[model samples]
Target: MADGAVSINMSAEECAIQALADRVMSQIADLFFAQHITPTPVQQQMLVSHVRAMALRSRTGEPLPEVEEALFEDISPDSMTLAQQVVDLFGNLPVEEAWLLSVHFEVAKNEG
Candidate 1:
């Protein structure tokens, strides 16, 4: 668990997805520590929730709803790189997954 660790109650069948989400959280936590970023509690909650959904999407092959590329034009390259690293762990997610995830990091980076 990271700085803003969350507990998610799930049925037995989804335990693996939970594990994956936790792993992602751990990596995010490490990034936060390494970069000296401290997200507000609310920001952390949103990031965690989004990470959980990403894990579910990875397992279920659910596509991310289409998002405009211009929407991410202002996101920092470092944040996008970190988001892409996390998305790579799933091995099956789309590049747009990184684009979407980058928003989370950007928000946290801006606010923290």
Candidate 2:
């Protein structure tokens, strides 16, 4: 280890898992844009809230709260169609941009 730094290593499986997480986030962002969901301040707040709840559940393996449940609820009524748009848009993002957006999404998901 360096003077004040600790070294860390990730297994291939761990790396893949992280990559998959990034992809999901990027897809969500693309969906948000494609749906014309211009992230208003309120929507941004909701995004943050949803991400935080997801992170907590992910870490603790606990059920999401009812309040959080509403955030993930099918608000669009045509979520299946919107989801397809997201997938299509995500397919077109550059690799670097997609990865960067994924990081932002992950952070927002955890901290929003």
Candidate 3:
């Protein structure tokens, strides 16, 4: 999808993925604020980029299975659930991607 392209021109698959990513990011900001967490400007920007990359990978049907097992323990149920919800937005993406999203959230939570 090139810049300035009209919405009607984009295919259904492209639209769906874009919608999912948009919603996921919006919901994430809501969730973060609801939890009384104030992420710094840099943290917010980083998460946006991370989510965009993850969305691209998911949409393109690529795989990312090189994460460390130790990272699992840091992912709380709440984080995992949020990650799953975000991942589900892009259809049946690999579970590893969800876990990776959880890792991102966990890191964000642990940060200032």
Candidate 4:
């Protein structure tokens, strides 16, 4: 550590996790453009952070927040579909991850 400075080191495992999050976000950004959804900078950041946290949860087997019982049943179909596609890109994430992302997409659209 330098004088008057604090240093934080990320492990190789952590680096890999962050890389996965970045890749997922990059692809999702392309998908958003293709789907004609313009994500604001705030939306992009929010979504990226959400994916990173979710990835950590899945990789660590941490309990994720439960989605509603209805889950995708009640959300906008387009957002749900978009979320499913994005989640698919993340590998074997729980379907609840998709539903959570669908809510994020739906909210981001309205807010953007």
> Which of 3 and 4 is ahead in TM-score?
4
Each candidate structure's TM-score, on Cα atoms with residue i matched to residue i, is 0.86, 0.38, 0.69, 0.84
Better of 2 and 3 by lDDT: 3
Q: How high is the lDDT of residue 38 in model 3?
A: 65
Identify the candidate with maximal lDDT: 1
The TM-score leader among the candidates is: 1
Candidate 3: the clashing residue pairs are none
Q: Whole-model Cα lDDT per candidate? A: 0.89, 0.45, 0.76, 0.80
What does candidate 4's lDDT look like per residue over 1-112, in tens digits?
5587876789987887898888888888788788777777888778888999876865677777666748567679889889889878867688888888897788766776
- Which stretch of 10 consecutive residues in model 3 shows the poorest summed lDDT? 103-112
Error of 4 at 59 (Å): 2.3
TM-score of 2: 0.38
In model 4, residue pairs whose N, Cα or C atoms come closer than 3 Å (at least 3 residues apart or on different chains), thus clashing, are none
What is the lDDT ranking, best to worst?
1, 4, 3, 2
Question: Candidate 3: where is the Cα deviation over 4 Å?
Answer: 1-20
